[model samples]
Target: MSINDIIAEKRKNVEEIETKIAQLNRKLSFSTLSEEKKKIMEEITKLEKQKRESEYELQKLQNERLNELAEQLRKRREQEKQEERLSTVLPPVEEFTLRVCFKCTEKTNCEAFLTKNRQKMLPCILSELLNH
Candidate 1:
């Protein structure tokens, strides 16, 4: 089962244990015999321990879920930052075409013009062309 399902089940178990303990306490109050009261008290003790264990497990699961969500949020933020950096480094499509592609005589079949790093080199190349 999923963590959420497990957590819900544990919570339910804790609640049921609490209810049982309450019922046993009510029964203990009405019991006239010493043996019957001792037996009821023992059962209540066991149920209370079980309730404590269930509550601890529920708290652990909730913390784990929170950590998972925090990790996902961190990764998404990093990806968005990387995309923003790329967008700032590269000129807009229209400006790149006008500044570099239109001015270059070898528009087609030019290795430097068609290479992946052309965007990085475009500014330097354009500056050299302007100087000449």
Candidate 2:
């Protein structure tokens, strides 16, 4: 996915988390209740804490993504300089490479890595090659 796509996805996730936090708070606002209220309060607190942590992570990712874009622009300018100096250079897009997360396949059974989308299964490589 593009960087914009990633940022959009993160924003959506943040919004979902915020909605959950709000829902938890609304649930917590009930005054008249049995011991269940206390249990609900505890769960709300946990959810709020988790939301805070996730917000922090989202902020970190936003900053990192901005920095990565700046660095990429800088590298592109540097490459232009090298091309001017050397008279031979590759384009920025050609320089990029993707490395698969083998561990992600093993652990989560990542659907994206699979050759064929299955109702239930990891990539074929995980079962066939990795023998797991």
Candidate 3:
């Protein structure tokens, strides 16, 4: 359950305890129900303690959620700063060398062109015929 829901439930329980306590007080005033009054008072004490515990738990959950959000924000900011640094440090795309294949009309970067040319240096027979 959400923190607000937990808090509302606990408050409702506390209100119920208070209402019972009031009823018990009225009964005690009217008749000699000492034993019943004692039991009700003990129950009231337990309920009050539970209410305090609930309030403490609600506050703890709220603080934990806030801390989690703050941590995520910190991580996001660090990631953005790292990205900015990378963008500034890296070379521009236009500065890199490019090559085009005469036979296949394929375009590629210098590294890829070197690898492809190293694999097969000769132009295709069909390309030579088309050129002639």
Candidate 4:
């Protein structure tokens, strides 16, 4: 049938074999010599092999999911950088040189100059702290 159906069938078989092995181990603890006892020991070994294979398959599926998540994070970062460039918004930079002129007694003439538009440089609220 489908891929999922195949995996489901394999998993079910593994569980059934494991249960059979557990039952056989319980029977093998006593001194016995029948042909059935030898057959149960062989079956237990086979079920142990199947259990290892199923565990490996589960680990492979988990690894694939981790790789998919890493790829999605890379794609998202690229998209955000492209959008920022198209909008023409400059990245923030330090304005360590912007200070008020020394023509006033108080610090009510502070300004924050932005490279985006010189005309948009408004008075800074830092003036309030200075007056207080």
lDDT of 3 by residue, 42-93 (tens): 7767767776776677677667768878999999999999988977874342
Every model: Cα RMSD to truth:
4.7, 22.7, 10.7, 11.1
The C-alpha lDDT values of all candidates are 0.80, 0.62, 0.61, 0.59
Per-model TM-score, in order, reads 0.69, 0.49, 0.48, 0.47
In angstroms, how far off is 116's CA in candidate 2?
Answer: 50
Model 3: residue 53 alpha-carbon error in angstroms:
1.3
Candidate that beats the other on lDDT, 1 or 4, i.e. the better one = 1
Each prediction's number of clashing residue pairs: 0, 0, 0, 0
Residue 24 lDDT (model 4): 78
Residue 102, candidate 1: Cα error in Å is 6.9
Which residue pairs in model 2 clash with each other?
none
- Model 2 is weakest, by summed lDDT over 10 consecutive residues, at 90-99
Best by TM-score: 1
The candidate that wins on lDDT is 1
- Global CA lDDT computed for model 1: 0.80
Q: Rank the candidates by lDDT, best first.
A: 1, 2, 3, 4
lDDT of 4 at 4: 55
**What is the C-alpha lDDT profile of model 4 across 1-132, one tens digit per residue?**
655565667677678877887887998876387787788778778878878887677556556656777899999999998888855553222331244223223333433332323333323324522554
Question: Which segments of candidate 2 are over 4 A away from where they belong?
Answer: 79-132
lDDT of 4: 0.59
